[model samples]
Target: MNRTAQPAGTPVRSVPSKFRGPFVRWPRIADATLALAMFVAVTSLEEGPGDSLVVRPVVDLPPAVLLLFAAAGAALYWRRHKPLAVLSVALAAWAPMLGSSYANVGGIVIVALYSAGRHTQDRRWGPLGVVAAVGAVTLDGLLLSLPAGEIGFGCLVMLGAWYMGRRLRLRSERAAQLRQEQAAEAQRIAAEERTHIARELHDVVAHRVSMMTVQAGAARMVAAEDPQGALEAMTAVEEAGRQALDELRHLLGVLRPKAERDGLGPQPGLTDLPRLVAQVREAGLDVSLTDDIRAPLPARVELSVYRIVQEALTNVLKHSGPHTRTEVRLGHDQCGPGISIEVLDDGQGAALQSVSGTARTTGMGGHGIVGMRERALLLGGTLDAGPRPGGGFRLTAHLPVQPVLGEPA
Candidate 1:
């Protein structure tokens, strides 16, 4: 058949890649079998002109049509891969028999037509050629004044078979195209998600790293004057930097298709309160904390509480002047249904200072405060930040402790 390569716009890969192999490359066994069956079935149905006219020799009764059919059947193997060549072979085999009362019977050319038509929309030509040749044969028989309906019936039979093959091939091609499109769309979605996450990391981690760097510089500058104090401050800065690096690695690992993240370790819970308070106290803030929770708390609830308090205190340091007063209140009860956090400070009454551009307040670019609110919402909670009714600034976070993770009751 014609192996004429389609132009660059062709869907077939240049050399039989995964993209084109299964779809375009005709299989040897299937080709050979189809060719044989079609040739035998079609040729057997033909009644040579000699048979119709009662000629003498049995071998000469009908045309030596089986030989031509055999060659056409074998040629089916390469039809899809080389359509022009296969089409030529099919025509050559069927050409001579057209003048006979009966032409080779098998509908082999229809299969080749289907294969070629799938590549181009011009599938009608296969049946057209058959019809035109049959018409010529019918006309030649008319010069002899022979029957016409029988020849017309044979031509219609071939056309019907060709139509069926074309439908089946079209369906197969559509399914393959849809599969390819779906795969491409999935890749696009994944790439977009990666880009979004990378951007979030750049905004969050970059800020933390900058803070750590600044603190480290401060510690080094004060080391000679206050050795033990400088040591503690440097250690805190080191810990902060290490945390940022770990989170950065987690985000980067997400870019890998199959790699899984260990997630930034376990998220901090309420049990971390004392340690967190101490970390800030060591940094020269005076903090008083109160807690009251008699019942066992859910993990997510405890995590939200820790984050709210952590961000609140971080803000106090960032916004409150050096001598500001800080107080934390956490409470829960059987009837409470959730937990609440109250952080109040005598300094910075909701006009939270940019504090060297470290903390982001309600309406600014900073993420620390926004992160606290996000944690609250994730736990089905609410956060209120503004000036206290009486005086100092306050941040109150209320979060559900009971998970609603079951079938509707």
Candidate 2:
């Protein structure tokens, strides 16, 4: 049986629906047993002579007194549902035995008081029930000429039982609140982890797949006229496919449980940019790179920079075609203590016109750009991607050099 977690302060049902058969009947059976016990205790007593209290067999009790005791005990069956009302009825029915020599039917009173304190929804009822019970017991004691200390002790005992029930209720509420907080925190962390994994998958697969697609098309176009060039294009396609598979394997290894993962390769960093530029050139794009970074960067910043540049160049290939001119520049930010990156491409291809026309109609970038922006924001940095003033697309990103605390440096 599965049960969803309930929010804090939500009322919990006493009996779940699945156990509604025998378990549901147990409460009534227990109440009936308690009532029978109280009735037997009260009726098994008698008075000897005038002013003398004594115990006798149950057979000597009159029918009317027995009926009253039975009624008082039976009222306990509804204590959980109507606690205050049941307490009142039990008190009234037991009034006849107040000064008699009966085994204290105070057991019935105690049960009713505890139920009222534990089950009542309204806070005032518990204390009100306690006060009423104490007042009734105190009045009976005074009329019977009982000692003051004995009366006070009786009141304290009743108060203590009610307090125990109330204390249990409070502790249950605190436990429920703690569970709710922990469940909420777990859900929040799961959502963040899912988003991070999705971003990584996109960055890993998109660029490699795009390169393979372009190389395959070029191979098909030039197969008849230039056999050697067609062979080189097919080789590029094969290499792109292999790189994609390797990256995906590394990603899956990272996703596995820590105990099961071993020998995972490190992610791409700034040093891998030259290789990336070389591959883009082989795909026939006129791409150039100029690196001027002076200081070493944290691993996270390096990965983000690599992914951002990869996504940007992939976008250029996808939207601007393979023959478009592009430049990737990396250097330290002159105005701030961080690294700056820019990818500029002349948007002169038919593919570029089609994408630009669609964007002009509906103003939004693709998910690749959105993922790049999210990475920058996560590292407390910024990214800007848009069409340049003259006739090209431009993407610029600035990332701080300091590593975030608690992260691998």
TM-score, every prediction: 0.44, 0.51
lDDT top scorer? 2
Indicate the worst ten consecutive residues by lDDT in candidate 1: 1-10
lDDT score at residue 373, model 2, on the 0-100 scale: 57
Q: Model 1, residue 261: what's the lDDT? A: 48
Q: For residues 272-333, could you state the per-residue lDDT of candidate 2 as single tens digits?
A: 98888888788778889999996888999998988888777777777777888998999998
> On a 0 to 100 scale, what is the lDDT of residue 193 in model 1?
51
Candidate 1 local accuracy as lDDT?
A: 0.62
lDDT of each: 0.62, 0.74
Specify the highest-TM-score model's number: 2
lDDT for 14 in candidate 2 is 19
User: Candidate 2: misplaced stretches above 4 Å?
Assistant: 1-25, 45-54, 95-97, 100-103, 187-191, 214-233, 249-409
State the lDDT of candidate 1 residue by residue for 264-331, as single tens digits: 45657777899998888886677898988767777767766876787678767766645567999888
